[model samples]
Target: MGSILVVMENGTGGFVDSSKELIAKAKDIAKALGMSSVAIGFGSEAEKNLKGLSVDRVIAVSNPELTQYHPEAYEKALAQVLQKDQPFLTLVANTTMGMDLGAGLAARASLPLIAYCSQLSVEGQEVLATSSVFAGKLMAEIVVPESGAVISVMPGQWPQDTDRGDPPIDRMSLDLPSSMKILQLIEPEKGDVDITKAEILVSVGRGIDNPDNLPLAEELAEAIGGVLSCSRPVVDAGWLPKSRQVGKSGQTVKPKVYMAFGISGAPEHQQGMKDADLIIAVNTDENASMMDIAHYGSTVDMLDLMPALTERLRGE
Candidate 1:
């Protein structure tokens, strides 16, 4: 077994929180398996960010175009790196980018891919990956091969590794695709409260029914001093901003208390807020996925419960 390679997710000029999460997990696995952990990053942002990272070694593909996310270039670059190093386990964040890149890399490099990995451990030089299936209703365990495998770790499951050290930087380059270019990139608007930092979150899903009912959830949040969050459908419906959305495509949150109203708990949504201290899910369907993970679950109508909870909190 060689080293564990982590494909870090880069942001504007630094790594994202998920990037540190992968790094943190890589350290844990490497320590348990007696293997070194290597981090691979892209472009100038990564170059600046990778220097002080606490890893055995860092490989930075210092191409300017690689700063942002170029699917073609990234797949090709990572393919080349995999061919040369062949780490025992390569970890990538199961993000929007990782979902696409990991699949492509697995196909091109002929390596096994374990997606939606929530837990991993080493057993006699073999890595056992626990993956969530059927939107977290079931769990499947996968064993990595002797040759190697690619694993996309679910975000918010692991803690962020902030320990910094000067790691040796290995520079590299490749034939990046020139056909595709980003003409304009617009960032999503920020919300007032960062739900990730919120101690309590009142999360809504498609169960909220109509936009007019948003005030009901808002009232409940205000009464409890919690922030208002929603699932992907709410963001898509323009009922909430992207910053307020919690899921794989949205923000990952681990609040002290997570109150989910009308959310059916898709796997993506689970990845965002499943690690909360306490989960209270309210859905009409008793068999909803959220009910399985929630500490307290209710089959009562969300509309009816929202008002009652708010009125009780307000001492009405």
Candidate 2:
């Protein structure tokens, strides 16, 4: 059996959380298949990050063209690496860069592609990938071709690999094409806090009614010493920045306590917060989807509940 390959992505500090999840899953798959797990990362910081991950081999391609995300440059560099080291299965994160890179590589390399995977397993001679389709209402299991396959797994579905290791790095210097250059790396302005790292969150939704009523939720968050967060509708209405939004398109959070106010709980929104240790939902509609999955739910108007909760917490 060939090695299990985990294609990693570089982020602000090091490898992104999604990539870490893949590393853990890859290690498990490698153990099952009696094969070694190998990881490939780009840039010097990625090399530094890859060195600490618990994998059998770490392939680091440190080059200027590979530092930032360039579609052509990355594809070219990765293609060369793939040709040199043909792994049986390659795992990619279901993120923006990963999606593009995985699809492009599958097409260019003529490899079978399995995307939006929530679970992956090796059974006998076949590899199976389970994906959620129809906006996550249905599950589709696909059989990966045994020759070779590329898979993209959804983020937040698996536990992140945190074990540290000092793996030897195999450095590669590819003669990558210079067809494109990233002139300015414009990033979203950093928010007051990283919601993904917060332990407690007071999240508001469209049920808050007006933007002026946001103060109630903010006060409640302040009183509880939690960060103020919101659903997609709240961000779309300009009541909160996208930074504070929690949903499929936004950051996925696994806080110790997640308080949802007036959220109708669309499937997209639920995907982001379903993993919270404790979910407390308050909505006017008792049948709201959010209420069904919440640990504790109340059908009281959030407009009435926020201030009362805030005062009670402050008094205590």
Candidate 3:
């Protein structure tokens, strides 16, 4: 039986969404490969938050140097742990920190590394990874040509298993790299709607046609108390900021409510928001591909319906 180590970054707020998604996928890999799964993370107080997972073991390395991310220090301490554990495979989330540390870890450990992988599977004494190429236009399959493999998984690519039983804890203290220390932390200015946290999102698409029509979609989002997102085309045309774009080339969202306005539902656009719990597409074209998966839709053009709905909401 093989042993795989799952390295998670438990930061200030808590364990990131991507970490949980990785653990879920790790559990599947562990089961399929007949391997034991051990979860490791670093934080000032990270143990309590991760005690509820179904992992075989949870290791918390507590230190102030790890309070904020310092890539070299993380690599050193994590390398020590990995060398000691000698796990057959290691997995981590493909985030900013992951990107920073992935190459260094692979070099230090002399293992094959794969980053931003969309999926993972075990073959005969080999692990296969899938990733996108050509700006998401093509998918490439990667195989790790080593006995020990390091993989960094993309966010929202794996489904999280919230039903896993409580995970056991194994607390430990590791030597901190003296060179690492947190200096200052700066937070970004949050928007009116934190699109990342929004459970319900109503995204505007290419069909809106003009920037002047954005307010109408904003009104609809306001009515539903949801975040307003856009497809790549809208952002490319400067109708919306790049931060608001939702697609394969943009942000990946899994909101509870996904309302597509005039979106033609291209494969690229659908790739971003396919995980939405409930999808409602409103477009004049009744036969657009977006309508195929839409739970509720109207054949009327959004231009004609939006003003009337806004006025009705305002009691006009």
TM-score of each: 0.86, 0.76, 0.66
Q: State, as a TM-score between 0 and 1, how close model 3 is to the true structure.
A: 0.66
lDDT (10s digit) by residue, model 2, range 117-236: 889988986778998666455669998876778888888778999988888888888776666677887654347678998899999988888999999988999999899998888888
Total clashes in model 1, counting residue pairs 3 or more apart in sequence or in different chains: 0
lDDT of 1 at 102: 91
Better of 2 and 3 by TM-score: 2
| Best of the candidates, TM-score | 1
Query: Worst ten-residue run, lDDT, model 2?
Result: 184-193
Clashes of 2: 0
Q: Cα RMSDs of all predictions?
A: 2.9, 4.1, 5.8
Report lDDT per candidate. 0.89, 0.84, 0.77
Q: Which stretches of candidate 1 lie over 4 Å from their true place?
A: 31-34, 162-164, 191-200, 210-215, 222-227, 238-243, 252-256, 275-278
**In candidate 3, what are the lDDT values of residues 1-316, reduced to their tens digit?**
5677887776558777778888888888788878888888777766766677788887777765675777777788778877888787788877767767887898899887876687888786567889755534456898766577788777678777575556678777767666756678754334344576788787888889999989998897787678788888898898877777776567778899998988877656776787889998998988776787689988888888877777887778
> Model 1 over residues 54-136: C-alpha lDDT tens digits?
99999999888778788889988888888888888889988888999899999999999999898998888678999987877
Between prediction 1 and prediction 2, the one with superior TM-score is: 1
